[model samples]
Target: MTDFTEYAKALRARIDIALNQVIPETPNSQLAEAMRYSLASGGKRIRPLLLFAGYRATAGQQEHPALEIAACALEAIHAYSLIHDDLPAMDDDALRRGRPTCHLAFDEALAILAGDALQTLAFELLADTPGLTDSTRVQLIRSLSRAAGMRGMVVGQAIDLAAVDTELNITRLEHMHRCKTGALIDASVTMGALIGGASDQQLNILARYSRSLGLAFQVHDDILDVTADTATLGKQQGADLARNKPTYVSLLGLSSAQARAYELYQEALTALAELDGDTELLQRIAHYVIERRH
Candidate 1:
């Protein structure tokens, strides 16, 4: 029997290597440099790995021939979001993975272009991955686009920015996060299920699991904002406080936020159970999402 952690480690390594291979360095290409700076920062590749693991737990064989491409495409989209998030007009984050963010590492203009290029590259990669049926390919493409587009992460971000310095009730905050953070995370799991050819029923169950997990992920992240070290987080600690942004902690207090995270995790696991498969990986990933120090 394979150790699940070891399996995850091997899988993440492969995904990272595949990501580097997808867009190699090219001189006179500062866009490449900016993209590299963000994508190579070495954060946990949870999103990509979740796609693989979700596929493994639900549908066809683990590491399906298309798994690598699916994982890489998800990571590419994630990296692009990070680049734009750290922009001066956006999050204004200076550090990521303990180093300068893309706009800080490269010029802002180049960083913007890098983000644009990466977003396009993500779709291109998905469209070109070999061995997937035409239906599955089209499904993944549309699924990813909707999750990242105006109705999803983009809207969530817009809500977040606008909500700053303004009072937001828990209902409103959750709605914002459901789009902003939850959408991408859900998309990650959904794409995995889709690529693995999960039935519509299985996909629906995974969607519930992903949504709960995504909310839990963000609640924990907000807690980490206060509890984690800046060096370990590779970003400023207390940033939410600094910006006066609405957060679980700010709205509910630390203990309450912690409680909410656990509650969401429970909901996630229950949803996972509803799907009725080998949940060892999903359970571990859920635990890791909440327990991660950084």
Candidate 2:
């Protein structure tokens, strides 16, 4: 039983500093403020944490500059996704991380622009990452772009939007989530492994671990929608149900959804066990993903 709480806290602090350095205050105060507002709004920072864990799992020694940039870039992408996801055209969320949503805190147009800026900034960070070989940088950029672009998160969002009020089977729902949330997560692990110079076999094993963990992450989220309160969840409780969204809980019932989360948790751990290096952190993250309240 590794204490992942302390590991997460330490890595999160490092990631926070990196993010602040990468997204410094600029001349354009409003856009900067909106960008900082959403980026700084505290969430789990799970993606970056997973990235670091992947690095560790590959026997990465020091905190490479490229690894830091990759972690920050992933967080930037995730923050941008949240900004757009909360827009009026999307989930129309009024709350995020226990505070007003970006669109409500700032204006809608600004929020949209802020998301756009963050998305571009993410790429810029990847492109300008220092000390990495050009090939490594290209691989990181390509993986991240695919994860964030039409083939990944965007298509997932499109599927989710279209599936609203429409019946979706468990397989279709899983596929949607794999594209939507899982792609980015898989990229995080892959990017970290690439930075650490993981072998192809190690990368494949990590991919399996990340994929299972990603779905478990979403499954737990669905469970929390029905189980946790607004303040506890840092957003509206039952918002998914209110929107008639197809969640694991909605499709499989709460008990079944919980069971499925545990199943995925085991699957992730199993994959991680196949990898060489200190994988305790990744294993603990799998546990955290399934057991998290929000």
Candidate 3:
């Protein structure tokens, strides 16, 4: 197997640099600091990495100015979601990425404002993406908006909140996760493919890949919550169980969850095999998703 560690690191460095450039520094503004804090707090940067991989697979370019903005915008949406998800009204977690969550580090109100600012900034970045046509920009904006809004992540969160302490069948659980976690992931790859000028057929294949991989991502997360510790996870361990949220592990047991993740991994690889161009990076990512420890 190819070691994608260095490849992932290089793409992550580019994404971090682009993120810093997109969000200006303002010491006087607490909101800016909060926004920057959450963005800078380290995670895997999986969504942006997927975007870069999709771009590389289709465009055959290692880097592009337009791809940078698109990746950063998607990450901003992700960062904003995390910020809100950790609020007192939401997950109410005290830690994230091994540091205090935005609400705890700053204040609740400021954290909320920071999330709001980042969300709008995401759209703004897409609206003014340099080198893309107006139609392309609009498409990107629309794609991200739907992924981040009611039709996607928002509704998913609503389902999660409602499902607390309630039983969810496998189909309902998958649907909930597809909306919450899978939608933006789907958007990430498709948006990258769009920018890279992928044909409709290629886009359809990628959708299949992303859909399966997205659910697998959440399944592995649920496994980690049970098997990993607080320091290792960078967040409260068992937070999902504490919230009484349904998970693959909760509903299907640990062994079955692992089985499900591997099944999805195979599906993702199957979809990737049907696509053209250098899909080595995307293939490696699918492997990483299923086998990741944290």
10 residues in a row with least lDDT, candidate 2: 59-68
Kindly list the per-residue Cα lDDT of model 3 for residues 57-118, writing each as its tens digit: 88896566788889889999999999998998888999999999999999999999999989
Residue pairs with clashing backbones, model 2: none
Clash number for candidate 1 = 0
Residue 155 alpha-carbon offset, candidate 2, angstroms: 0.5
lDDT of 2: 0.90
Candidate 2: TM-score? 0.97
Model 1, 153-250: lDDT tens per residue? Answer: 89999999999899999999999999988888888888888877788899888888889999999999999999998988989999888999999999
Tell me the number of clashing residue pairs for each predicted model.
0, 0, 0
- C-alpha lDDT of residue 135 in model 2: 94
Q: Rate the local accuracy (lDDT) of all candidates.
A: 0.86, 0.90, 0.90
Stretches off by above 4 angstroms in model 2 are none
Model 3: how far is 4 from its true place, Å?
0.9
Tens digits of per-residue lDDT for model 2, 1-294: 346798788778888877777776678899998998888777898999888888889965567767778888999999999999999999999999999999999899999999999999999998998988899899999999999999899999999999989999999999999999999999999998898889999999999999998899889998999999999999999998999999998899999999999999999988987887888878888888887878
* C-alpha TM-score for every candidate: 0.96, 0.97, 0.97
